[model samples]
Target: MGFCNSCGRPIVKEDYGTNKDGSLNDEFCCDCYQNGEYTEPDITLEEMIVRKTKEMMAKNDRLPETHATAITATFIPGLKRWNPEFQDDYKTL
Candidate 1:
């Protein structure tokens, strides 16, 4: 018996079909094929609260949400590296 990673349902080998990557998986399950009720990406409570707070404050101030959201986001080390547009405009090479 194999358990579906996405749905937690116990599936028999005969019920499962091979995925393109060759993993034995079910053909009919929503999680198996991403048909419905997808799981959200894992986020910590701290991250969740910060995102909401920034969005809320931005709304009250009549400014775009990214203002506060960017501040919180830039503190996350490697995440800042991913945003090339935020790089210092004056720095050359």
Candidate 2:
């Protein structure tokens, strides 16, 4: 029941991506990572936040845009893929 590192969606086994060696990549979801590569490698943190906020609004009509933005802003940075140190350590991964 862990969440996706990219979009914050609940992760199931099928949602996990494959690693370089074809093993499961537990940290990221299939939409964010495939074949050990980022689907949107050039996307900035702010862009991800904006995109996900829209999706959140669409998925839950009661969730206001402002609240979605706030939630994404607060949550994304803590995900493994968005962590500054983690990014710095594995810029290519």
Candidate 3:
């Protein structure tokens, strides 16, 4: 059976989301998605946690120092393709 990406619980058979490439996510269930649980098919388990932590920190106005949060520079080259905001040319706050 599939499992929830955020909580790692068994996902209901019908709750799988779509993958980045359009395949079935087979990770998160609908209940989790509807319950504000993190859901994604592109990022991995660890990546999701890190991203969520960063988001939390930003929301709380406590962004961690550079050394505290490892910047995955290698991701920029690929992430920029899907998320333009990550591009240097893009203007974001």
TM-score of each: 0.26, 0.85, 0.28
Candidate 1 vs candidate 2, TM-score winner: 2
Q: Candidate 1, 50: how far from true, in Å?
A: 0.1
Error of 1 at 24 (Å): 28
Give lDDT tens digits, candidate 1, residues 1-93.
654443333567664645556565453233343323223446443554475456557567865566656644444322312235645641552
Model 3 agreement with the true structure over 18-59: per-residue lDDT tens digits: 544555555455533443333443555456446645664676
RMSD of each: 15.2, 2.3, 11.6
Worst 10 residues of 2 by lDDT: 84-93
Window of ten residues with lowest summed lDDT in model 3? 72-81
The candidate with the higher TM-score, 1 or 3, is 3
lDDT value, candidate 3, whole model: 0.48
Q: Pick the candidate with the highest TM-score.
A: 2
Better of 1 and 3 by lDDT: 3
Count clashing residue pairs in model 1.
Answer: 0
Off by over 4 Å in 2: 88-93
Error in Å for residue 27 of model 2: 0.6
TM-score, candidate 1, is: 0.26
What is the descending lDDT order? Answer: 2, 3, 1
In candidate 2, list every pair of residues with a backbone clash: none
Model 2 per-residue lDDT tens digits across residues 1-93: 688887677898989987878898877899998888889899988999999899899999999889999999999878877887777757684
